[model samples]
Target: MIHVAQITLETKGPRLLFLRKEDPVRFTWYEDLVQEEKETEVFSTTALEAIRLAYLYWKNYSFKTLNCGFRYTLPERDEHGNNALFHQMIASYSSMNGIYFDEDLGHNCFVNFASDEAKNLWKNLQSQKRL
Candidate 1:
């Protein structure tokens, strides 16, 4: 089986074992009612790494952003200004879903982990307008 983990405060819950169980509304947004198939995140091995990837993904949140709409645009501050969009989106979509172990999809057996404090930290950072 592929062992994967996510760093989130919600370590012990149904989410720990299930994918796309965070927000039913959001999940349904991308699901096909006829097929009953829902969209889910590709987790990583570390929470921070996962959040970092999410941040980059949010930075380039656009149509055809990437495979499955996940992009990895680095958050860099140039003469223009800080790249706050990525941080903002990450915070907005913060959800500390936990680890997962899947027997299928051997190649993606392991992905980066998401921080336990990703949701909270992102919320706080957003509140402070740090992003």
Candidate 2:
């Protein structure tokens, strides 16, 4: 089954830490690891809680709005063979909003605001595909 693996956001400093559905002790361990690896303070509790909430909602529901004016919608079906529908939906919305989606990272996907460069890349990529 599809799962919400991670949520990444662009910030002024280092990326915020958001744990998934791990126990408190494990989560703390992950936080410590991030601190050691990144050498940056990661806000785990609040950010992780937020990501958990968003993930739960997305798992049960279809769509959600991010802090920015961006909205994320999950695909309806879980068929492994076809991602065309999902890609098409993302492409249409991304084009309209000037946003671009990154390659799927495990269970979660990443999207960023489409600047001129991103738009051109997305357009070029889309032109060669059916969906």
- TM for every model, in the order presented, reads 0.19, 0.19
State the lDDT at 25 in candidate 1.
25
Candidate 1, residue 22: Cα displacement in angstroms equals: 12
Off by over 4 Å in 1: 1-37, 62-131
Q: Considering only N, C-alpha and C atoms within 3 Å, which residue pairs clash in candidate 2?
A: none
Residue 4, candidate 2: alpha-carbon lDDT: 15
Give lDDT tens digits, candidate 1, residues 1-131: 11112222233321111122233222111211232434445344543344355445433332111111121222221233222222223522442431122222122111132344444534554576533
Q: Which ten residues in a row have the lowest lDDT in candidate 2?
A: 26-35
* lDDT per model vs. reference: 0.29, 0.33
Task: Indicate which candidate wins on lDDT.
Answer: 2
